[model samples]
Target: MRILQQMNAFCVMTLIAFSISASVQAESPAPVQAAKKALAVGQTAKDFQLLSVGGELSGEVKLSDVNADGKVVVVVLRGFPGKQCPACSAQVGDFVKNASKFAAKNAKVLLVYPGPKSQLDQRADEFLQGTKLPAPLTFLLDPGYTFTNAYGLRWDAPRETAYPTTLVLDESGKIQFVKISETHRGRSSAAEVLEAL
Candidate 1:
């Protein structure tokens, strides 16, 4: 009877551990098939200027400004809360960890979140809090998806969200690397973008 009880205790502990691991892995949920159509390498990224949450001044920032003196990593995020998007947040967090690495390689990181202009500033501010993305990172609002439409990241699938993708631009503002998620889950990691640089 003593041996049986010990085995039961061990099984319970094992189950608890597995449960915790799964929760940690869910920091970002992956996107489905429709968000995938990524751009090709060597493509010249279109220039875009967006209004930021820092306060409304229309077109205050240009894509060229972010990628100007170094390489730039453009991250597309699910705009607002139709539902909480764990995957988009996760991908941004992954790149946040490597902000310095990109800096060391003379690169910039741009985090773009698109949604309707209504409540966009509030939503973007909340999303950016505690992300640890410093000066080199530019957080932009694609209000009305002005930038999203230009980039072709609009996912019109039934009940689907925006395209979750990543682009690496060289110093001259030309795309050197591109990662279009086949589903929302498959974003390019910090290591992958670094390797391309």
Candidate 2:
């Protein structure tokens, strides 16, 4: 009878251990799909279509279509990582400050905002409250990091969205210039992108 009791206790302990392991696994966050390599210059850029926050694209924008006529400056912003990013605003201001230059070069700018699907639009609207996007610039929304993951720019860290990437693509969709910042600062400037064009 003691051996039988010991066997039953062993079975109960095994079940408890299994249950704990399963619970821990369930609570752990899923692994993020890390980029094999950052998108480099001279490589062809992947085309994507995402909802537009404000642009001449009629509430939707496609990369290829935007770059069809001229070169495109793709800016990936850290969208609502709990609050508005001042660096992003400054970078955007730099781009907007040079709007005329980009237009003169026939280069259209597409700002990519990446964040959660819930309240993304509202957050984007808040981000653009005071600033105005000129005709040469468009705001694209990246819900659930779809565009961010596809482009291999997902930060996937605590209080992070994208890696603050900037890529200038030619009319043929070939990347001419690419700058990816691992941190909040070191964003691409308007003059640099204009020179790339």
* Predicted structure with the largest TM-score when compared to the true one: 2
Off-target runs (Cα >4 Å) in candidate 2 are 1-38
Candidate 1: residue pairs that collide: 28-86, 29-87, 30-185, 31-183, 31-184, 31-185, 32-183, 32-184
Model 2 local distance difference test score? 0.86
Judge candidate 1 at residue 175 and give its lDDT: 78
Tens digit of per-residue lDDT, candidate 1, span 12-114: 9999999999887754333322223335677788899886543212347787776667787888887764755778778777776776787788777777888
Candidate 1, backbone clash total: 8
Ten-residue stretch with the least lDDT total in model 2? 28-37
Estimate the TM-score for candidate 2.
0.80
User: For every model shown, what is its TM-score relative to the native structure?
Assistant: 0.73, 0.80
Best by lDDT: 2
For residue 162, what is the lDDT in candidate 1? 68
Off by over 4 Å in 1: 1-38, 54-59, 130-132
lDDT of 2 by residue, 1-197 (tens): 99999999999999999999999866523322233244677789998999887854557788888888989999999999999999998998898888889989988999999999999989999999956688798889999999998887888889999889899998899988988776798889998888889
> Candidate 1 at 82: error in angstroms?
0.8
